[model samples]
Target: MKYFKYTQYLYLVASILFLISVIVKIINQEEYGLQAIIAVGFAIMFFVRRRFVKKMENNKKNL
Candidate 1:
């Protein structure tokens, strides 16, 4: 369960990589619509998962 604590950061890292790819694509004058969308999705997931994990941890603490 403690390993779950750091797994959320992996989403953040993936989001960052996607964002960087989006930037690179933009610089290269390539289409990045889908990549941009996926990047945003990952960013959103990171926040949502982090919140969910924190809530779960709090619940575990209360148990």
Candidate 2:
């Protein structure tokens, strides 16, 4: 449960990595549409998980 708080950041990190990969692929004149899509997905997941973690923490506090 304690780990859930930090795990959300991993998604952010993965998103960043995917974005970087997209940039690199662009520089090399390669297709990066899929990576770009996945990066956005991960970014969304990061935010969603962050909110969920905050909700969990608040619920714990209320308990």
Candidate 3:
């Protein structure tokens, strides 16, 4: 349960990074492909973190 807090922070950071990548791609015509790839990676990490955090919380309750 305590460590779940860290996962929550990770989710926030991942979301921020994803948004930043999107913004970077939108503002700059060049390197759009790189930015898109980064954004996709961040998005995947964000969702994974979200699911892991939920699982952790559930496990704590089961304890």
Candidate 4:
């Protein structure tokens, strides 16, 4: 499977943003539950993005 280099960069940026948000929430002692939920949301989004990318690659290969 192939991905644009820019897509990989975007993913890396997203991961860093998620990590920073989680750390900031923890350090600030904000609602840990909300923080956890947001983190999970980010994870789910990442998963979906990867799945879609994979599907697109598969379709391209079949064509």
Question: Which candidate tops TM-score?
Answer: 2
Pairs in clash, predicted candidate 1: none
Query: Sorted by TM-score, highest first, which candidate order results?
Result: 2, 1, 3, 4
Query: Could you tell me which 10 consecutive residues in candidate 3 have the lowest summed lDDT?
Result: 29-38
Q: Which stretches of candidate 3 lie over 4 Å from their true place?
A: 1-28
Q: Model 2 residue 51 lDDT? A: 95
> Relative to the unseen true structure, what is the C-alpha lDDT of residue 28 in candidate 3, on a scale of 0 to 100?
77
Q: Provide the clashing-pair count of each candidate structure.
A: 0, 0, 0, 0
lDDT for 61 (candidate 4): 92
Q: Estimated TM-score per prediction?
A: 0.92, 0.94, 0.62, 0.57
Candidate 4's C-alpha runs over 4 A off are 1-20
Can you write out model 2's per-residue Cα lDDT over 1-63, one digit (the tens) per residue?
889989999999999999999999999999999999999999999999999999998999999
Candidate no. 3 TM-score: 0.62
- For residues 1-63, what per-residue lDDT tens digits would candidate 3 score against the true structure? 577567656656765776786787678755566656765776677677778878878888999
> lDDT per residue, candidate 4, 6-31, as tens digits?
36446556666767877887899775
TM-score, model 4 to reference = 0.57
